[model samples]
Target: MAKDGRGAPVGRRVMLGVLGLGVLGAATGSYVQNSYDNLLAQISSRDPTGVTGLLPGGGGFRFYSVSESIPHRSDQDYKLTVDGLVDRPGSYSLADLHAMPSTRLVRDVQCVTGWRVPHYAWTGVKLSDLLDKAGVQPGAKALRFTCFDGVYTESLTLDQARRPDMLAAYRMDDKPVTAAHGGPVRLYAAPMYFYKSAKWLSGITVTDHVEPGYWEHYGYDVDAWVGKSNGRDDDPTS
Candidate 1:
């Protein structure tokens, strides 16, 4: 139901298969960009890979997506809907988000799967500000984030969602976020595992209770704090 990166409305693409990163790059004609789109485009244009985990960073870190093909969106056609259990439901365009006060977080990005990318920088609007702007209603105890990718979803309790470090991010590493990296915007949950920060972010629904998200439903902890929730003793990221 959302538009692709080229501004054309498209259905959610499913992950069908995965090819080796080396073969993917060679067949696709260039080294995979650190972003999501180039790699996904190569996959979509050729074969499908259920490549949810990607080590495009020369093994320094990993980039991942659950689906084989990624959804794309241009800022001009991108829209974010904040609704469900709010007194003042709102829909925001990319420009509207850019005008808001932004917060920058330089925190370690940890994946529950055991890789870490330290001191990555993210820039975006505070989720708390957006909730306040929408006038969140009483009994809304959790926030559910739905991504344009169609298969991924994540949640946070009201307290976690309001953390000053949590952001609805549009920029990463001092540059505009690319499609491969979950732009025009994505969520950044600094204290939680990387999966808590959903990419291709599209909808925010306020709910009366916390519903376990995509990975949580599959055995990952719903409250995915870096070292605490997943039973690993890694140092905390925040």
Candidate 2:
């Protein structure tokens, strides 16, 4: 198995495939990344055939239950609230997010299930910027992210939440996010599996200890690093 940039061991199957293709004169790193991203686009553009089809490249990404999906709302009526352990607890509209300094990144999207989509482009605000604006208190040790779907929720340790790659994403594929793809806003945790990037994100509550998210309580690892925690032995996206 080859180690990813973060030194996590990649699955032997993935490493073998990649190495075999290298013998065919294919450039390994960037080329594989671009191919994976293209595959994700193709998968997302079509109706899902099943769990396998809903994810990129057949069935490598992890899938979690929503418990329930919330009703979709238009951008005009959408609101995101930042509350909990902060000096400034306030609400932000879609316009508010658009008005902030925006960032764009193209990085690998890995899942615990074994699939990966590399070089996927995401555009949004740095999560740290929002935390800074909200004035996170010294006591804040975790961030709970609640989705509009009501059933989906996630939490990150303070250090993880502040990572430069984390984003409150508004756009994907160079366009505004569609409802099927997590919509008007979503949490993008670049170093973790796609599940950590909760869809239809709505609320952010800063707290003092780690809170196991919906999936975490149901056998998923709370600190879900791509290869390190899930028992799947995949490569780290970072």
> Judged by lDDT, which candidate is best?
1
TM-score against truth, every candidate: 0.75, 0.74
Q: Please give the range of 10 consecutive residues that has the lowest summed lDDT in model 1.
A: 8-17
**Mind giving the per-residue lDDT tens digits that candidate 1 earns over 1-238?**
7755865333333222234554676676432343454444455445445353342432234668997787899999989999999999889999999999999989888888766676789999999999999998988899999999899999999999999999999999989888988999999999999899999999999999998999999899999988898888668988
RMSD after Cα superposition, model 2: 12.5
Candidate 1 residue spans exceeding 4 A from truth: 1-60
**Candidate 2 local lDDT, 178-216, one digit each (tens):** 777787998999888788999888999999999888889
lDDT of each: 0.84, 0.82
User: Candidate 1 vs. truth: CA RMSD?
Assistant: 15.7
